[model samples]
Target: MTDNRTDPDPVADERTTLAGFLDYHRETLALKCEGLTDEQLRLRAVPPSGMSLLGLVRHLTEVERGWFGRRVGGRDLPPLYFSEPDNPDGDFDDLDSTDVATVFATWRAACAESRDIVAASSLDATAQRRDGTDASVRWIMLHMLEEYARHNGHADFLRERIDGATGE
Candidate 1:
């Protein structure tokens, strides 16, 4: 097996902008989730803490749809959580959707969509959330960055459990 251990600090340089932070985090999360099989990636905690690398990817995809596509782009896309099913964890409980090819394609699509949306708008541009509250593109970028950071931390532990290797 190939060793995937990284430098442990994915973002060593200062991300000077919110968009930069978002990009940095996206990369960091991808790193944490990398080099694992679908089985290893989808392993959940006891009774399922509803946590997994694939789950995080799904959740982040939904977040991208909500924050960037719907809010920032003014697109009325279907909400992935409330309308898709009744699962409180949203996209985290995908035990049956374990097809690696499908999950990978979906994740890549989500990342591409998010990048396009970010590229199309300025940081100061404002958009309303589903609740009709205002959100700046800057806010979405920063929020996603933070979200990825927290979840990637979870992924770190999960990966460690999957294999003895740990770092970054």
Candidate 2:
């Protein structure tokens, strides 16, 4: 298969570099999952982990919402996949009952909204956490970049296990 990932430029400014790296990792996650059947996407190829490509997408959706929607925008939003008191691991654990299209749509929407939020705010812009702690947009972006990188690593393994497909 053809490689589709866009490399982040090394000479870019801080903001451009951060955004490019985040986008690169995001695309890597999607590329790792491309062309797989729904059943394949949901298969827990790596035993004892309970992680699927679909679950990764769902979890990232919630992560995007938590950081960008609720924390950064201060919008009153309900939990996307799981609640605090019940089924907190719904994103990864409850994949069998999920509609693949809906999960993908939710993830896409969350990512778009996150990009919009970041675009409209200054890097130094601050937001409040649930615990009343402060977080800057820069920090949120960096945290999200880290989150995507870590999960994309999981996606790499899962994809490779699901099929022989590999590489960025």
Candidate 3:
């Protein structure tokens, strides 16, 4: 596949560097899912594990909404795919009736919203999380980077298993 991802700028400032890397990881996830059919995207390639490319997209949508929208932006939004106590794994589990187009659209929207939130706020700005603890925008960005990096690793393996294709 053609990799359209731009490498993070080496001489950029702290904020720019973090955002660039986070975006790079985001693009990595998308690249992993590129050219796959709907059934392939939803295929649980790894045995005994319910993880799939579509599930990763759905889960990251919730994560972006939670960190950028709910926690950082101070929006009282509900979960996108899963509930708190019940069906927490719904993002990964409830894919039988999911519309692939809608899920991708929602994920892109969340990423855009997150970019807006980051652009409007300072890295030092803090917000209260669900546990009444405060997190700075810098911390949130780092956390998001970590989250995406971890999941993207999974995406790499999943994609390879699906089609024997692999890359950084």
Candidate 4:
């Protein structure tokens, strides 16, 4: 996106913006699901936990919407992964095979919107935390990076279980 796509140097300082953080997570997630089919991606790797690669993708999408859309975007969007009459983990619980395409598309869209919001503001810009605490865009970027890195760790193990593959 920075006209550096062809840069062979893998060590380039690519993360100069919060959008970079978002892109970093997206790439990490895609790696977690590399070469996986919808069935493999949705194959709830852990039964009792109901955590699958697809679920994580769906969950991350919801997280972005919740944090950036509802909280930072300051829109009255509905909550994800939580519903009174519905299952508590909506993102993980929904395993409808037919919805795979729709879910992935939605995830990508949410990420784009999140990037747009970050691109429109200064990383030092402040926003209220979902809990009404104060935070800067930089804080959100760092938090999401930490979160995705941790989840990607879990995803590594889960992905290996799906089909042995590993990396940062």
Candidate 5:
């Protein structure tokens, strides 16, 4: 893969720095999926692990919706890709018949909504978590950055094993 990701400026303010890094990681995940066919995307290249690039995309869509839409925005939205108790790993495992274009579009929309939610609130703004504990926008942003960074590492390995393609 081409390392087209731009680095966040170290001198920027906290919000800018966090947003930049988060955006970069998001783009990196997309880049990793680029040029892949739906079948290749759904391939569990790493084996034993049920994770596929398509699965990662679906999983992140749910993450984005959970954190930004449901929690921060306080919207009563149902899970987009998976449900607990049954098909908990549906996001990662239910890929054989998934609509690739729809899934990708949903992921993009979720990211856009997440950006909007972040924009309308201050970093200090608080929202209630599932346990009724409050969380700041700052904390959410950092958590999302961490989430994507970790998943992108998995994406990196999967991409490498899939095509011998390498690098950021």
Candidate 6:
């Protein structure tokens, strides 16, 4: 894939740096999924793992929605994929019947909403977590950066395994 991801500015302020890196990683994931058919996107990694490019997209959609929409934006929204105590892995596991276009659209929407939330809030602004602990916007962005970095590694492996294509 042609990498169009913009590198995070090394000397930018904390919020700018975090948001930039987060956007870079987000673009990385999309790059990994580019030029693949729906079947290719759903192709599983090695056995015993349900991970796929499509699954990663779906999972991150939930992550963005959970952290930004619910926690930060304080929107009372329902999970887009999995439900607790029932289908916890629904995002990754339930892909057979998913519409790729819808999943991608939802993910993009979630990301847009996250960007808006971050733009409007102070870095030090706090949100309540599931455990009743407060999480600052800065902390959440950092956590999201970590999450995307980790998952993008998986995306690398998955894309390579599928088509022998590889890059940062």
Q: Which candidate is the best by TM-score?
A: 6
Candidate 5 lDDT over residue span 1-168, tens digit each: 556778899899998998899999999999999988899899896548899999999999999999999989888879877788887988898799999999999999999999999989899999888898999999999999999999999998889888878877
Displacement of the residue 43 alpha carbon in candidate 4, Å: 1.8
List per-prediction Cα lDDT, in the order shown: 0.72, 0.86, 0.93, 0.74, 0.91, 0.95
lDDT of 6 by residue, 1-168 (tens): 888889999999888899999999999999999999999999999989999999999999999999999999999979989999899999998898899999999999999999999999999999998899999999999999999999999999999999999999
User: Candidate 2: where are CA atoms >4 Å away?
Assistant: none
Of 2 and 5, the candidate ranking higher by lDDT: 5
RMSD of 6: 0.8
Model 4 Cα displacement at 3 (Å)?
18
Return the clash pairs for model 1, or none. 8-168
Q: For model 3, how does the per-residue alpha-carbon lDDT over 45-144 read when each residue is reduced to its tens digit?
A: 5679999999999999999999999888988879979887989899998898899989999999999999999999999999887788998999999999
Candidate 5 or 3, higher TM-score: 3
- Please give the distance, in angstroms, between residue 25's alpha carbon in candidate 1 and its true position after superposition: 1.7
Each candidate structure's TM-score, on Cα atoms with residue i matched to residue i, is: 0.80, 0.93, 0.97, 0.82, 0.94, 0.97
Pitting candidate 2 against candidate 3, the one with the higher lDDT is 3
Q: Which stretches of candidate 5 lie over 4 Å from their true place?
A: none
What TM-score does model 3 achieve against the real structure? 0.97
* Segments of candidate 4 deviating more than 4 angstroms: 1-17, 84-86
Could you say which candidate leads in lDDT?
A: 6
Q: Residue 26 deviation, candidate 1, in Å?
A: 1.5
Q: Residue 159 CA error for candidate 2 (Å)?
A: 0.6
Regions of candidate 1 where Cα sits further than 4 Å from its true position: 1-16, 46-48, 80-85
